[model samples]
Target: MLKVTAIAAALLLSGPALAQHAHGAQKGPNGGPMEDVAGVHAELVVSGQTVAVNVFDEAGKPVDTKGYTGSVMVVSGGDRKTLQLTASGNALTGQAPGPVQSGAAITVVVKTAAGKSGQAKFSAP
Candidate 1:
């Protein structure tokens, strides 16, 4: 019983280290911050009043946007706006009601055709 308790404690202690490894440092191909979502990478790029979210696989290859639906919430200058994204080639694009400035906080949530879903947070670049 003591051995089992020690093993359990060790496992619990290593959980955070393992999780950090799984989501370790990632860089977007478009010079933006990248994050893992639903086992894939989501890169966010914002310009003027348009925001583009490009999805890529673990290997950094663009993923097909077929049947993918998503939304982006951008907060800038103390104003928050939510924009519906539509599939466009390998990326999803949306036009915000107002200009999305650099360093704006953003949250993206997506649902794939396969029923997989995930959300990621980023700062507009």
Candidate 2:
């Protein structure tokens, strides 16, 4: 009984350390693993006048957005516009509607085939 109690205590103490190390394997904000927006893995990228978003599954696989739909709200030129997003293959890309200067805040919401919704927030580069 004493040996079992000691083993249980040791296991409890080591559980947190193991979990912390496991979480370390996940990617950080700067384009490593997909950023978790709300409860989904989403990626945000700004290039020229377009903002590209890549949504992935829970297993870190790119999700096909053939019938998926999404929208983006970006603060550009000191104003915000709700832009419609269209999914191409595994990505959802859209124009900012108006000219977006650098360093603008953008928020995106996507609904996948499984009726699961996810959001991702980003700033223009």
Candidate 3:
């Protein structure tokens, strides 16, 4: 019983470390942060008034987002905005109603053409 209890505790402690090794964070080609979402990599890129999410496969190659849908929820201070994204080229692009706050955290939700869906948050750095 003691051996079994010890083994269980070890497994619980190592579970997250194993998962992190399997899907480590990556840097996307667009110079943005990449995060795992629904077995794919979602890169968040912001430029001027445009917000984009570039999708990539596990191999780090660009994935065609022809039918992928995405949205971004940004919260800064007391303001919150949810922007709808449109599939275009290799990314989902949206226009922010105003400038995104530097301290704001953004969360992206994506559904691929193959119907895989996931959401992840990108904290301000």
Candidate 4:
């Protein structure tokens, strides 16, 4: 009974980690790849000519839209538009200068507190 209890506790402790590892890179709330950095959760979403991002705190609460900057490079009509993003609420939203057609590819570069930078890629549907 003692050995069984110890094994069960160990399995319980390792279960979450195993699940995370199995999922590898999982999608965030907005259906984009999410990477956890330090205490922040960053996600990227691409739709039409707009690429939106939402940042959340460690406790899954949305963070303020301040002190965070991002740039998006989206390919549309054989051209690329590099737009600077503006933060609103917990999201960073931006519009490409030109019309972004379907099946476009987007790359986002984000900088947060302490000048930490991260990148995410997305394909429009």
* The 10-residue segment with the lowest total lDDT in model 3: 18-27
Clashing pairs in 1: none
lDDT of 2 by residue, 51-100 (tens): 76776666768767887788889886668888888998877889875566
Clashing pairs for model 2 are none
TM-score, candidate number 2? 0.66
Per-model RMSD to reference: 2.6, 6.0, 2.4, 5.9
Q: Over the stretch 2-109, how does candidate 1's per-residue lDDT look in tens digits?
A: 999999999999999767524434567787677777767888888789888898886789999999999999988879999999998879899998788888889999
Give the Cα-based TM-score of candidate 3 against the true structure: 0.84
Cα-based lDDT for every prediction: 0.84, 0.71, 0.83, 0.73
Residue pair clashes in candidate 4: none
Error of 2 at 22 (Å): 14
Q: Where does candidate 2 stray beyond 4 Å?
A: 1-33, 37-39
Given candidate 2, what's the lDDT at residue 29? 45
Stretches of candidate 1 off by over 4 Å are 1-9, 20-25
lDDT of 3 by residue, 44-115 (tens): 888766788888887788888888898999888888889999999878889999877665789999988889
Give me the displacement of residue 68 in model 4, in angstroms. 0.7
Best by TM-score: 3
Q: Predictions ranked by TM-score, top down? A: 3, 1, 2, 4
Worst 10 residues of 2 by lDDT: 21-30
